[model samples]
Target: MSENLKKDYQLCEEIGRGKFGTVFRCFSLVSGDDFACKSIDKRLLTDSLDRECLEKEAKIMQLVTGNPNIVQIFDVYEDDSYLHLVIELCNSSDLFDRISKRTFSESEATAVMLPLMEAIAHCHILGVAHRDIKPDNVLFNEWNLLKLADFGSADWFLGGKSMSGIFGTPYYVAPEVISGRDYNEKVDVWSSGVILYMMLAGIPPFYGESAGEIFEAVIRGNLRFPTRIFDSVSPAAKDLLRKMLCKDVSKRFSAEQVLSMSNSCLILIVLFKVEN
Candidate 1:
């Protein structure tokens, strides 16, 4: 632990753990404000790529800090052995845990998705792409407001340029990414679409016994809505999914377009008092 970090905050019990490090509940000594300190073990970053990713995560978090749905990073501290990130504390369960607990109504799913897409749009507008956007990275605060966290796989994609990398979770990765093609920020939109599909259908649109199988299914890009599972899902919702999950990058809807369609439905819901 860094001496400066210890002097500035009081680290409490561990709150979460991941492949790279542990997150702890911490309190500021000066203001008594609560925060999460993600302490990354430097020893585990065994290669140059791992070190670059750590730095990029911190930079991207800071770059998108002001968005309402993106988690905030308050401070960064580095010592010889560990790197610490003081981030906004979110006490509620992650989206994955919440989804596993119960089924969601279309309205409920819409509510969750609106803020999430907003966050993605914000990132894209700022020239950043959140390559990894699975449910595990979606957090909630005490008030149940959604927050997009963990930008470990985020990168810049400015001026409509394509980015080349295989960076994303299997279940939600874009088809272009699976094919090893140069992709842009639209990849995040595809991942968000998968999240929406999971929310409504109670499962991912593409699946397999292993990551390789999942990638094959993704690359094949055969999007379907099983009648039994999607019988109750609204047509407008399905239309949005089709646009978002389109394999052809040129045909896929951007984050802003998805938000526009969603907002339009929300307007109709208000006028006609519809459930969808």
Candidate 2:
């Protein structure tokens, strides 16, 4: 840990752990405010590409700092051994954990998704693509507000340019990404669509026993709504899902377009209403 970080904040319990770092619930020495401190071990980031991605993630988070739906990064500290990022602390569970606890109705899912879409729109508008958009990356604050976190796979694609390389979770990864084709921010839309499908039906649109199988299914890009599971789902919700999950990248709905539909009262109303 950095000496400067310890001097500034009191690191508390371990809240999260990943490949490169562990997240701690920290309290600021000056203000006594709670925050999450992600302390990354510099030794683990021996690869130049890994270091570059880490730098990019910080820059991207800083770029989208004002977005309400995205988690805010407050401070950064570095020493010879560790790099610490002090970010807004989210006391509640992640989206994956919350959804696992109970099923969501259309209105409830819509409520959760609107803010998430807004977050994605904000990132896209800033020319940043959050290559990873799985439910685990979506968190909730103490007030139960949604916050999009983890930009490890994020990168810039300014001016609508395409990005290459495959960087996303298997189940939520876009087809273009799996195929090794140059893709754009629209990949986030596809991942969001997968999340919506999972939320509404209580299952993923595609599945398999192994990562390879899941990747194949994602590449095939066949979206199906089984009658038994989706019988209660509204047509408007399904329509939006189809648009977001469209295999044809050229025809897929952009984050802004989805926000536009959400902004329209008719679509919003239709999406929120439960079918008889």
Candidate 3:
């Protein structure tokens, strides 16, 4: 807990709420800059493990703070009853809202993904794995640039080491994770592929009425690019999705590889525009 937090910021109206706490729009008393402040109630944390998880989230946010593609953390405040996280204020809504409002064109979806992949690659370079990468955690700034947010499930991953846990949203969980197998950062790549699929097709590739059913589907890895929705999608984009959504972790593309492939896809799009 920082001593300066109380003196430095003024909390405004609540903007959002979750199981842990409420998020408020805040302003820095010194700089007059607006930010988002997440207030987590200490009482809601059932045990020491919960407290440790919250602290870990804050540390991971601090680790990846500089990138424009990720939301920046300004400070953390803790008192007897609550924990506060002062972070970048993104005025625009999350990706889920945008997708619900209307389907994104393939080009528009690619544009959204470019910066996202960059952020993921940056996190990987720093040895951080963002286990949760759903549309709800992907926000757009006022400029409409995508910024990855919500690091509550993030963890530090060392190379060649496997993390064991069935963590992550059911629809986007990697097959290895669903099978309760040891997994690494490639889990994020699987989630990214699910995001890309939903962005293009306007639905998740693996979805069920219940989490258990979704887990089964994920483990089965039954992927499809239905002609009704994906017929017009470029083969290059589908290829990338296949590589990303691969059931085998060893075959999945790394964030860096995805970025490189995305660059190639962008080039092809440009060439087609020029030729036509």
lDDT (C-alpha, whole model) for all candidates: 0.91, 0.89, 0.88
Q: Kindly report which residue pairs in candidate 3 clash with one another.
A: none
lDDT of 3 by residue, 1-276 (tens): 345676999889999998798999999999999999999888898977667779898889999999999999989988888889999999898998988787776678889888999999999999998998999999988998789999888878876677776678888888888787878998999999999999999988997889988888888888998999987777788899999999877888999999999989887766655665
Question: How do the residues 131-240 of candidate 2 rate in per-residue lDDT, one tens digit apiece?
Answer: 99999999999999999999988999998688998899999999999999999999999999999888888888989899999999998988998999988777777888
Off by over 4 Å in 1: 268-276
Question: What's the CA error at residue 107 for candidate 1, in Å?
Answer: 0.8
**Across residues 169-257, which tens digit of lDDT does each residue of candidate 1 receive?**
99999999988889889999999999989988888899999999999999998999999998877777888999999998899999999
Each candidate structure's count of clashing pairs: 0, 0, 0
Task: Please report how far candidate 3 places residue 120 from its true position, in Å.
Answer: 0.6
RMSD of 3: 1.9
Off by over 4 Å in 2: 263-275
TM-score of each: 0.96, 0.95, 0.95
| Candidate 1: RMSD to truth | 1.7
